[model samples]
Target: MNRRTLLTGLASLPVLPLFSGFTLAADSPLSAQPPTRLAHPPSYWRDKVSAEAWKVLFEEATERPGSSPLDQFYEPGNYLCAACYLPLFRSEDKYDSGTGWPSFTQPIEGALGTKLDFRLLWPRTEYHCARCGGHQGHVFNDGPAPLGKRWCNNGVALRFVPADQPLPPLRG
Candidate 1:
């Protein structure tokens, strides 16, 4: 099915309470500290990221599910915000949710900020990078045990840094 058709169908479905009252906790010691916030307008990121990434990060557009190679990518690395390079998630939290997009069980503490989204005619928790305020994705409760939270992310909105390599400096 097309993206519009799929999203339309999703909008018609009942909103679940999976995301209600959910909070993020640090999964490891490395994630204990949050990145400092960056004060840059969305336009500042337009030239830094690809057109498609710009749409997802700044325009709050969702990419088609299963379109991101990160969906199947399992590696020892970190996932940073594509727009500002803030480390958002660790590789250990990555998992297969069979939802096409990259899924995580948790995020680095203080790495994201969420607000209620009503674009679908229902309340959904939309998360963004805490540093640059770039849209990342939504968080849901349907996930593995312990936390039972799924951090569904747009692959285009993220840049993976393999564990063997040094992370690039954060961009504006």
Candidate 2:
């Protein structure tokens, strides 16, 4: 009808595709992304994890930068969720991001899930262990070549198993 109305409608068309797979709930800012369910109960995890691991994984607290020795730890091994023992990152993918945290170029296939984080008033892709839904870290674009994805992780949340050792069986 009106020129202004027509222009507004056209501009909005591009945004519709961005929301294609996500639905806004009636009462929350949360997208269609649902909370990842874990096989073990909260009590089970609480009993299994250290207080620091519990803070980072379940409470979503970030460890102090350079606090984890895992950042300098380069042994061939798998990085697993401290709470559930799920293998999340490979030693090969891990690198010296110099960000004071353990960094990986990518996660093991099918081992991670991501959601938006708005803590700093900016949106960031926060990823978690797909199996136990434990918060591992945020993935950023600043990383070495190839994938260029910096999966910055909290050392408190990860348990590294050296190549010489066998990974513990996955917890249900």
lDDT of 2 by residue, 38-141 (tens): 66645678878898998888778899999999999988989998987878889998999888999988777656666667697445677776667778889888
Compute each candidate's TM-score over C-alphas: 0.81, 0.78
The lDDT values for all models are 0.83, 0.76
Clashes of each: 0, 0
Residue pairs in collision within model 2? none
* Residue-level lDDT tens digits of model 1 in 73-98: 99999999998888899999999999
On TM-score, the candidate that comes out on top is 1
Among residues 3 or more apart in sequence or in different chains, the pairs in candidate 1 whose N, CA or C atoms overlap within 3 Å are none
- The parts of candidate 1 lying over 4 Å away from their true place are 1-34
